[model samples]
Target: NDPLLGVPIPEVTSEQSSSMASPQSNVQTNHPMTHHNNKWTKDHPLNYIIGPLSRPVSTRLQLHEQALFCYYDAFLTSVEPKTYKEALTQACWIEAMQEELSEFERLEIWELVPRPDKVMVITLKWIYKVKLDKLGGILKNKARLVACGYRQEEGIDFEESFAPVARLEAIRIFLAYAAHRNMVVYQMDVKTAFLNGYLREDVYVSQPDGFVDPNNPNHVYKLKKALYGLKQAPRA
Candidate 1:
């Protein structure tokens, strides 16, 4: 065995020799500044960016797009009004409320009368909602005036409160029967719904905020038809 042939020579090659000559240059360890400069080279995804912390500040187009998507995010909304005062501030909400009142008038839901003595007048609450299309764009502004029936006594305001709705089991059974009979069941929604019901019990509700009749500011509404928040609304 040739010891010289078998033993590995630790001779520095051109690349190694150059590297050794100026270790700082060739074997480049990052300086503090350089480390910081290259530290965030990795892509920052939106999953980590989160909210207004690092939100895009590129262009007006982006700003407009951000507003459109603010429905899914952000603290403030443009359409939904939390209070009647707030609702009155926006024309759209005002129009929606007017429309709702118009519906009430058309359906003869209530009659304006002098404030009843010793009778409880349930306060009305205004709920403002923006109806959105399937694609997330707003379709219309919906305003609902609901009676606060919490103050109503069980026997006085209502004898029984029940929802006139089909059970899930019944619905499923009907669907199954339809399928078995090979009948194509057509679905329809009642546009519909509540105001048609006649209220047997006497229910008094306060006039809506920002819409109190100037002539009859002290007048209250005597509800003949079931309103949104009445306990007997669904059944009446």
Candidate 2:
């Protein structure tokens, strides 16, 4: 026999039946009544909860599509050459290197002098690289003249070679301090950073390849300022 069998059924009054049938009365049902109603219903709790979820998914999809379109547009723009002169200049690596060497000499990074007796002279060479923009487009050609510092003897050729440089944390701290003081920060770069440092030791370097002095081909350079690839060059 069932436990609820033989239990007396309570008679429903007119007011109680009316209240039970009303929509407001359904909302006021206890937890047990609501749970039982949901179990028998076709619509589950998850169905109602998922109604507001479509908006963020749609927004994210639109953002991804927009980013892809922008990337494609930028790629096509970079692939299209802007002018005929730019196209021609891009093919001239030797000319670019020569021009860079001329600029380096004009900046007075070193003085052309006779190769001194019993003094070690570092060999120099031209290094070529292509400059690129943030969007991966070729911006310009770059040429650097670097010295072979491996041949340099530590104490005999140079002394006290280490140069101090500001760390990234120090730079961040400086910017934060400036911001706290409510000041605007500006940035400027030296055209040739190594060329600005005064050299204490007597250092000499050979003329860059393909750029021998027209009047004095036999002479080497006595460096007054630091050169790229020098072991003791100062850092800015």
- Scored by Cα lDDT, where does model 2 land? 0.73
Task: List the candidate 1 regions with Cα displacement exceeding 4 Å.
Answer: 1-79
TM-scores, one per candidate: 0.64, 0.57
How accurate locally, in lDDT, is each candidate? 0.81, 0.73
Question: Residue by residue across 207-226, what tens digits does model 1's lDDT show?
Answer: 98888999999999998889
Q: For each candidate, C-alpha RMSD in Å?
A: 12.3, 17.7
lDDT of 1 at 96: 88
Model 1, residue 1: displacement in angstroms? 81
Off by over 4 Å in 2: 1-91, 167-169
